[model samples]
Target: MAQVLGGITTSHIPAIGMAMDRHEEDTPYWKPFFDGYPPVRAWLEAQQPDIAVVFYNDHGLEFFLDKKPTFAIGTAPQYHNADEGWGIKPIPPVTGETELSWHLVNQLIDDEFDMTVCQELRVDHGLTVPLSLMWPGNRYQHIKVIPVCINCERHPMPSPKRCYKLGQSIGRGIRSFAGDQKVVVFGTGGLSHQLDGERAGFINKAFDQYCMDTLVGHPEELTRLTNDDLVEKAGAQGVELNMWLAMRGVLSEHVTELHRHYHIPVSNTAAGVLVLENED
Candidate 1:
């Protein structure tokens, strides 16, 4: 049977993608941020999972105010990157595992999670940036992907509890697939930093650290926080952390955090990264 090897969580700040695209890693402004990923790259090289189920939000690139699905799954054979109004990030297209994606879709619906199925989708920096950070130098070409897009851009988004439960459903779906594929799930976004309004540039390092520490063992405690609370404390965009809960739910109840990297003010965001493995 297919096995979920583990899950990874990280911030998907667009500026990080730009820094990489422009070859600015050594610059003083970006060096600290860039320094956090070598270990992640090394870890991924060793794990070498065959598939990555990416959970990220769209920032008006594919879905706009006209229509937005709270939960969408990409079933396409391949997904291309979007411009996001600033031109597309130069990266190889993401190949998809269509059969597994369809199976997951059916399983999720059977589990009472309504998801928007997309046969064609364009990924934005929120998805591509993390992929780049994890599998740099086009190593992403070696593995297939299943894009799981969650709606965190608008109000009435999925609640923290709902997101966690959705992740549980995804974990069940992956484990039930009849194959020997090695899979890794990703929850991309957050670590508390706001972008916009008078409170813009707001960040709560304490709350971010608490989340990183607690999510490995007691994700249930995080569900107690409301969206308002996340926005107020972590910043507006920080609410995207809800996506990480889904990634966490896909793992074994007990997980060993193999790697963690956190850095401040990565383009007005508290960038965080973690690699977790299901305890054998």
Candidate 2:
């Protein structure tokens, strides 16, 4: 059976990707944010996980408003990164863990969760930025990827509890897989920041801190918030915290927070990164 090493969460702002493309990590504006990843990268180097299950929301790259599934999983053998108008260069193709992905699809469906299974999918910054942040350059090619996308753009989005349950289902599936690969789950996007509307550039540091602290030991508390409550407090786009909840769901009931980084006003977003290890 596969071993779930742990999970990671990072903000997936396209501007972060653009900064890396422009080699601005050390610049005054970007240095503090970029400085947060070295310890995480070192940890990855020490524990080279064989597979990564990424939880990210689509930003009109692969799915659009016209046809967006609440939950989607990639079962393709390889996922390609394309130009998504973020002006950032697309990274190399990511190999997929097909067999395990199929296993997860079966498990999720069997667990009474409706899922959209994609045999071919094109990824955007939502998926790629975190990879580049963690692995740097082409080093991410070392592990196979499995993408789990949640719909953050449309109404009727999955509730935080629902997404967390999805992660639980995925965790069960990974443990039951007939292989011994080490897996790392990624929940991308959000601390808090509204992209548009009357309260554009809105951010709630208090809520963001509450979430980060609560997520370490009491994730269920976050699930208690309705989508409206989340939007009202976290800002519209800040609701992407669903992805973080999903990542936490995949871990053991007990976990240790290995590292965390939080910085505000990164492209008008409250960027965050967390490293959690499953406690036996």
Candidate 3:
């Protein structure tokens, strides 16, 4: 039987990745950022999960606004982390879990989740930053990735309720997959911060705490939150939280919080990391 080993939520701030690569973890700007990586890495190592079903939103880099799909899954055997006009990072591409990804894709489609399956796609900073931090080094070879791409940069995007439902569907779809494997659900994005207009540096400590609380104990409340509500509170760019809610939806209702770290000034964004325990 397939089971969720645990859940990880983190901000996909690209600068964090650069700092880690440069061994600047002790620097004032970067030291606080390491708060969650140790716990996350330990969590992954302990669970020894076979697959990582990553829930991350592309920054209009991989899937353009014109051809964006609300939810996309990578069914590829290998995924390259490409640099969109910017250059590629020093890190290498992430190899994918083909069989499990295919099973999830086929099962999700049958379950009526409209998902765009990609055979080959470049994972932008959104996916790579977290991957680099969580599983730095040749560790990627030991773990396989299944990406769940959400459209957060475009309008008429998936509503909060819709994303929650999609997560639920994905959870069921994976469980019913009939495969003998354990999987981990990683929800990557914002605690609370804004990056646009005059509100580019807004950080909502209250709202971020509330989000962490609801995601663990009362996910139903989170599911009811609208995209507009998040933008109003967390900032327009903060609506990327829809991706986090999707990952939370897959876990059990009573999730134990293992580690949490929140910090700001990483370029007008609040960066944080939270781990949810998966029992049974």
Question: For model 1, what is the alpha-carbon lDDT of residue 120?
Answer: 96
**Against the correct fold, how does model 3 do in TM-score?**
0.95
Per-residue alpha-carbon lDDT of model 1 for 84-187, expressed as tens digits? 77765657798887989999999999999999999999888888888888876656877899999998899988998889999999888988999989999899
Tens digits of lDDT, candidate 2, 176-263: 9999899999999998989889899899999999999999999999999988888999999988999999999999999989999999
lDDT of 2: 0.91
Please give the lDDT score for candidate 1.
Answer: 0.88
> What is the lDDT, from 0 to 100, of the residue 225 in candidate 3?
78
* Residue pairs in candidate 2 whose N, alpha carbon or C atoms collide under 3 angstroms: none
Q: Which ten-residue region of model 1 has the weakest summed lDDT?
A: 82-91
TM-score for all predictions?
0.97, 0.98, 0.95
For model 3, name the residue pairs that clash. none
Model 1 ranges with Cα > 4 A deviation: 87-90
Candidate with best TM-score? 2
| Residue-pair clashes per candidate | 0, 0, 0
Residue by residue across 1-280, what tens digits does model 3's lDDT show?
A: 6788778888887777767767888887777777657878987888788888898988867788578888899988888876666554645768787776787777778878899989988788888777878877635766788999988887878988788877887787677777778888888888677777887777888898888777788888887778889888888878888878888888876778898877775766887688888655
Weakest ten-residue segment in model 2 by summed lDDT = 134-143
- The most accurate candidate by lDDT is 2
